[model samples]
Target: MVEIKRPSPTDLLTIGEVVARTGVAASALHFYERKGLIHPERTAGGTRLYPRHVERRIAIIQVAKRLGIPLSEVAEQFGTLPSDRMPSLRDWNRLNERWRARLRARQLELERLQEEMTQCIGCGCVSLNACLVMNPGDQLGAEGHGARRLLPIEDEVPEGVGRDSH
Candidate 1:
């Protein structure tokens, strides 16, 4: 009879075990280590061993990637977490709040883009020079050239500018 060994909660996991459990590629794990996103201990033979909490960290990293957040930003956020121990629920909640704001802003920008595209399609006049609704008397050119409306708005819209002006 073959006996299957079950890992205890306190036991450090091998790289193979982590890959199997997290469904992340071994290459990706190595890349994360290289990027300073995760820190694992090395055995006398140089085998990597990850703490149980690393699974949670990898999950956070994967979610950030899916949301289009840069790895640099992930590293910035991770910097706030405690390195000596697993992150607490409160720590995770703080990160969630920050990411939620960014995601909300992105969602609003996408919605704005969708509305502008719908207006452009409805007019059937793709000519920017003749489009009075989008550009009138080349006013946007005064703000510096190249798709002025497509640029991300950082502050209050200027008077006689933007979709609201149309």
Candidate 2:
């Protein structure tokens, strides 16, 4: 895998540069700004000016989105990030740790789902007798009668359900 290098402190990045570095679209970055997850300043010419830290934040935001985390949750997970300054090491570390845990949980939940799917495929739905899909841990289907559920989960779970652990 290729290593991602952080830009030097002296290097200020444009929104385009940040986009290129993070592999996130400019529109997505704008969406993050609207959600208060990331922000870039307006230049005198009205272009967006971003710091190197913003690139890092964009990367984090993208991964969180891929894990099905809504922008609302991401904002809650990370307190307001200031647009006028560089993010501190402590802030980055705390955010990184939190997101990593969320991603890990998401991976585990997905693994659980995949295993149940494999069981279903192999045992001809007989394992649905014990699987989370057919028989969740609790009276999950009691709330409503439907083909599917409003909430995908059959039981109450903490945030970031499916995560991959190394």
Candidate 3:
């Protein structure tokens, strides 16, 4: 009869071990599983076993969360990785580059918001009828409804208005 060798416990981490090592709650790990972000192997007794490398994945997810990157975007980026193995250093670099671009865009948007926020909120009308002074006869209404000025403009801003006008 041939004898089979089982992998050492160190090769696979149980859910509790993963929570301890990653400093993530077990419920969060389960949430990640449900979101299809991480895949773990199951034991005969219905135990979950994660590869040691899952800690890296959890770290990446946490960073993305901290950056306000939506889980859907994280999942999309993770989709680019090979499912069979841990992400390589090159893979991590690629993810970093992608996230950096998103962060830059977010920073610019936040700056724009900060510059405009004072005026937007000052009137208390919040782009309603009282905003006619800034908007002027509902000219912005021609473009669209719902705080058109607040929306990001794709082309040159309309003349005779905006942050510089006031």
Q: Mark the regions of model 1 whose C-alpha exceeds 4 Å error after superposition.
A: 1-10, 130-166
lDDT of each: 0.86, 0.72, 0.82
| TM-score computed on alpha carbons, candidate 2 | 0.58
lDDT-best of 2 and 3: 3
Q: TM-scores, in order shown?
A: 0.74, 0.58, 0.67
What lDDT, from 0 to 1, does candidate 3 have?
0.82
Clashes in predicted model 2? 12
Residue pair clashes in candidate 1: none
User: What tens-digit string does per-residue lDDT give for candidate 3 at 1-166?
Assistant: 9999775433789999999998999999999999989888999999999987788889999999999999999899999986557778899999999999989999998887665666667746655544644555676577766665555773567775675665
Model 2's alpha-carbon lDDT is 0.72
Count of backbone collisions in candidate 3: 0
Per-residue alpha-carbon lDDT of model 2 for 1-166, expressed as tens digits?
9999865643677877877777878888888888887767678899987767676667667777787888788788667555556677887788778778988998899899989788777877654335566777746455555535456654555677654422
Q: Which regions of candidate 2 fall more than 4 Å away from where they truly are?
A: 1-12, 80-83, 111-132, 137-166
